[model samples]
Target chain A: MAKVVIEALVARFPGDVYDPYEGAGGDDCAFVQKSKIVEVCRFLKTDPAMAFNMAPYITAVDYLGAEPRFEVVYNLLSTAHNHRIRLRVKVPEADLELESVTTVWRGANWFERYCLDMYGISFRNHPDPRRLFMYDEFVGHPLRKDYPLRGRQPLVPEREVKDIFRGPGPVGRD
Target chain B: MAIEEKGLGERDTGAAPRSAGERPFEGQHRPETYDGPLDAPLGGKQMVVNLGPSHPAMHGVTRAVVALEGETIKEMKLDIGFLHRGFEKSCENVTWGQCFPYTDRLNYVSSIMNNVGFALAVEKLCKLDVPLRSKYLRVATAELHRICDHLTLVAAMGLELGAMTVFLYGVEARDLIYDRLTEICGARLTSNYVRVGGVSRDAPDEWVEKTLQTLDRVTELRDTIDALLTRNRIFMDRTRGTGVMSREDALDFGFTGPCLRASGEPYDVRKSAPYLVYDRIDFDIPVGAHGDNFDRYLMRMEEMRQCDRIVRQCFQQMEPGPIVVEDLRYVLPPKPLVYGTIEGVMAHFKLVMEGIKVPAGEVYSYTEAANGELGFYLVSDGGGRPYKLGLRAPGWPMVAALPHMTKGALLADLVPTYDSINMIGGEVEQ
Candidate 1:
């Protein structure tokens, strides 16, 4: 299933997709150029043989030290074909943006917003690009590799209560 | 939904009177007729009502900024994340094994499913296959959790819709199942019963017979509730046509599980991509034609029956064996082995101090979670902890489609619609 799709993809869009091959996990994977992501997704969704209709999950993994610092992964599924394709788009730290694929699949709406809120990788033309999980007052992307796990950024001022349980945080409580 | 560009406060431009015997709207298709919003706007002005993060009847912390033209919802904007505790960020800092408890909290109603889903993902990364007995046990427990989840949905649906007896029946059935679950996992709400390679424990003696009795009672109660609400005049009137979605629109919105199935799509992860012992089971996926709240309710009710069948088959087909895999690296050694041999002691010490070292790769594993498709995309870097864990929550798409579903529908219909979506805040927000 993956080989057929990959071969067709490479034949159609010669310069856009990179490293088109089945991943070690048996999923058809391709690292597409960031700029042509929407085009690729639209083509995949509309293509008869590889009708990847649903963009079920989309996430960005922060490779903090790598040259292209972030990898935005799109897990696409075609209920018609019963096959899945994972598309990864590399984004540099300098340009933390990618064109939105909302036009192709409406389901990518919140996933893109979640990516923006959690990883700080903004979608260029998302209709409602507000933070999906975190508050507007949130300081930084919480899911980034550099974001300290113990970092406490509260929405409200803390109040002094009795000693709870001892655990890891900015201020230890016992 | 090509809705009018008019503000909620703006007067209704649609003056066409409604035709009798006309059908309720479907999909995101905005109705053209100016149906009176609760007997035509009270003062000819649209009212904006905020349904809450704190209000009763809301299954979880979710806020919908609804613009009401009378009682008809003109537009809606959802403000969520009140229950968000950074599930992804928290799990990334913990060991792969520690993440089980975290996943358990994702869908607290049927937490075993979340645990199983995450465990399957990790097992995929490790390329480890669990024992046949373990697979059967996983299927049995997961099916029981499915019954519990559907029971919760039906109970809440009935309670919110003014059928209090149905809620009581639903809860009664659920309590029996939870008691059976507690006997096995030692926890009620969050059962962290799954490990990387297999399940954490085996079933207690006579547990199968007791569970069968519980399931019989549950089926009885479910039948009563079904009779009470499925065809009842009030329940049918409210849910039969309200919250309808077109087949194409549902797919476009990335709906999975019952919602997608209720939308006339016969796509079920269990049937399409069988995992665990699902391929061995013979069951049917209930498909709805109307794609409305009633269909979704019926879908869950029928699925509970199917779950009963799956669990019974599991108990009958399963044979006693080691629950976890024999892999010393992934599974902890038995108590006797740890105290008897130096090799076992070393393996136990290493396994406890340092978690299972999964090969560095990524895998997207999905399961037929109660609400929809609960997917876990795990990225490993050959470390004790996971590189990234992205949750594709089943209820997220349904919640996102609230505005679209309620457009031009009556205010009273929103309750059943919301209830039918079965949005568990833990998973959706996380």
Candidate 2:
């Protein structure tokens, strides 16, 4: 069932897309070149036959020792066609930036921000490139494999609340 | 004059109708302080107001910074993650089976659904078929949780929107279900009752009968709340045209579940890709036409009725069989067999020491959760610990689109809009 979608994509971007891997659950996944990802996404959305309209989830996985340290994943769904495709783009650690697909699908806005916050993979030209989950003062991308599970972070002093009923009292240190 | 004509309870929602994208929230910001005369006339600028990371009216720990021009909202920026405990990071470090307790907290309101979703994803990766009876149980329990989730949404929505009776009725019905669920899973909330291959236990003989009786009372309460809010003039006037998201925008913003269905998209995960025994069950997906708050409320009401029908049918169609899958690698052997047989002891030891061995691959399993499509994108590296567990919390996208939805609507309208989205911060912030 997913083979037909991959065939359509291959026919369209024969030069750009390669290494189509069929997942164990029969979901078709194809890796697109980082440079042409947004173009591929635009085509996928606008094309009638492959109208992958909704971008449900976009996340990143970091391989600590691998050549391309991070892989950004886009899980695209098409309600019109009742199908979904997984799009992957590998990014090297040195150059951890890729074109954002928020323009292709507005829903990708927060997910891209999340990827940036968690994996330190920047999305170029993102409308709002602020961290989605972590605070602005957060030191590192917490989701990276290198980040320790119980790593200590610098905490700011609690602000003095003068007119509050139940205040955040002083941190007791003898 | 218009306010005097209809008063607060009956003011038309479309009194100040603005076009789709006409600088509603775009390019609107509170200006920097001005150095004017001490008694100078007031500069009519949009006032910035912050609502809850801990405010009483807020459903969860989320902060919305809104720029208000008069009573209408000119812009809104949502600051989430106050409740994020790094669900994906924790799940990645833990064993596949150990992840259930963590998934249980993702949407703590309907934790069983999260367990079911994760289990389904792992089962898909392992290519294991769940037992028929367990499938029925999963569907039934999931629907029950769906009702709980909707009840929470409706109750909170009512409490904020000046309908205290609706909140009371909704919570009472939800409590009745929770009592039965406690009997089944030994917990009121966060039931980690689903395992890799199947569920934790079967429904007791009388459990089905008790649940059926509870459903009748729930139906009565639901109908009462429906009567109170469905046609109430104030509820209609407040919600009729505010928070209007069009069909195109809803799809474009990746809305799913009841909210998506309310926007006229009949794309239910259960109906689109029937997993479990949903194919055999007789039920309908109630789709809404208007993409407004009232329609969203109505969608939940109708979907609850559908959920009731589904639960009843699952019990009737269920056949007597082993509740858990026979796969020893995934399921723990019964205590009697574990103490008696050497094979059982070996299986139990191996399973306890080293979790179920799932083949290395990735699968994005989605289910029709109470809020919408709850998806878990899991990548396994042929090990006990998962490589990556990307949680697609259904509320994430909905909360992301809040600014867009409430761009030009009144600040008061934000309550119902937030309620209808049903943004459970445990899942959304995670």
Candidate 3:
């Protein structure tokens, strides 16, 4: 896996793979430029030896005190070898823009959208950039560290909700 | 106002109309926030149907506003957070020992798995090794939880399809297992028996014998149900070709557990990840060909049989020894020792008051819950409390894949598709 990641890096970026963290079971992860994740991932999936065929999950960690305050981790699995790889990509809390891997793995579309919604991360050229959990009226991201749990917006009036009922018969249960 | 009115489609025209009948409900149909102009780009007319943040058959307070072209869903926008009670944030505020009870509510169907996952995460961060006996007990309770969860799924699906008999039979069988669980732990649903380093207490010898007996009956019932449903003409017609998901599509959508396995992927976490006593247990990871609703249903039934096999294996191979490891720093001193011995009393007091201080480390712990690979990621900043805790819930992934599964399919197939996934809203939102 190290050999594949390293080769993918060298072949694609020539000298972009830097500061590699090689774990047990020959899993190779490197701190590549955030811009190159999409390109690298596309190649990694298509690359004959690597074949990082499945995207298990994608999650972001807030390293508030660290120099790089945010890190996105991707867990990838290969059905061919039944091996797993953990890829870490670091980004600053201030500038959390990273390329979306939706082009490479369609499974990442919702996850990337969720990360964007909750953590206020920016995904460049995402297919559908919409808030996931929060409503259209919600102003700020809910999952960010600085975002307060309490809301500033006033609750919707009961009168407003009552107006929306238009069915003839009893709606739901009587 | 209460008034006497004659029947035959209301003969109250002579009497004054009630105040409630005079009001007309009318309002502007505009969203609270508008980002841009509502102009279409050469598209067909779209009607919207909102499927609840609070509606029946949503499982919980989850809503999806789906745009439809006639009866077909053109696009869907999922609205969540009705059940987000900040359980993860609460995990930080509570003591390590106190958090076990809270984990019970995350996936209420499979509380034992949640306990095991949360405890395992903390244990890994603290670098605490559980005793061999503790491992066996964890496996037993976890598998039992799996059986119960799968039973609920099958029964719920049966109910949705108007198979009231199947639903009742499934629940009756599950109740027997729940009774066994109650014997082992005082609580049936919210069994916070899994402690950080070990279980809350050792299972009584008679309780184990009873559980084994209950499992024997449960296996028989599961086989009977499988036989009843697998070849039934109506069951096959209703489920066999309904909500089919291709293997490629299933993988692309991140579908796991029986949903993924039904598409012919053998990615069981017990076999692949090998956590707890799973490495020692002998069981098969069942897979299906068509990835249809029936295949998903049948796979879960087969899985219950495997669970029975695993529980029996635990009982036969489990050695009688100390269930809790002798790590006083992590595991609390025994109750008898705490009451009788002075040193043990102080140890227990300190553990209770100050809480166990896990070292500064981040670890991702994965356990095969009833749903799928339920993972708990804990980051501790060398403090007594966790800096951040994230639960990798399986329900949301299945929910996220709903659009893919339901698209181009009949609107009526929606219930069967949703029920087969058995997504508990708390599991997704939390």
Candidate 1 residue spans exceeding 4 A from truth = A154-174, B1-43
Model 1's alpha-carbon lDDT is 0.86
State iRMS for model 3. Answer: 3.8
- For residues B296-411, what per-residue lDDT tens digits would candidate 3 score against the true structure? 98788879878889999998889988877787788788789999999899889878887888887566666777777677767677666677777778776778788777775556
Candidate with maximal DockQ: 2
Worst 10 residues of 1 chain A by lDDT: A160-169
True contacts kept of each: 0.60, 0.70, 0.26
lDDT per residue as tens, model 3, A39-127? 77787788777777777677777776787887777777666666566667888877889999888777787778778876788798888
DockQ for every model comes to: 0.32, 0.46, 0.26
| TM-scores for the candidates | 0.91, 0.90, 0.84
Better of 1 and 2 by TM-score: 1
Instruction: Note each model's CA RMSD in angstroms.
Output: 9.3, 6.5, 13.0
lDDT of 1 by residue, A81-133 (tens): 89888989999999998999999989889999998998899988799999988
Better of 1 and 2 by lDDT: 1
List lDDT for all candidates, in order. 0.86, 0.85, 0.75
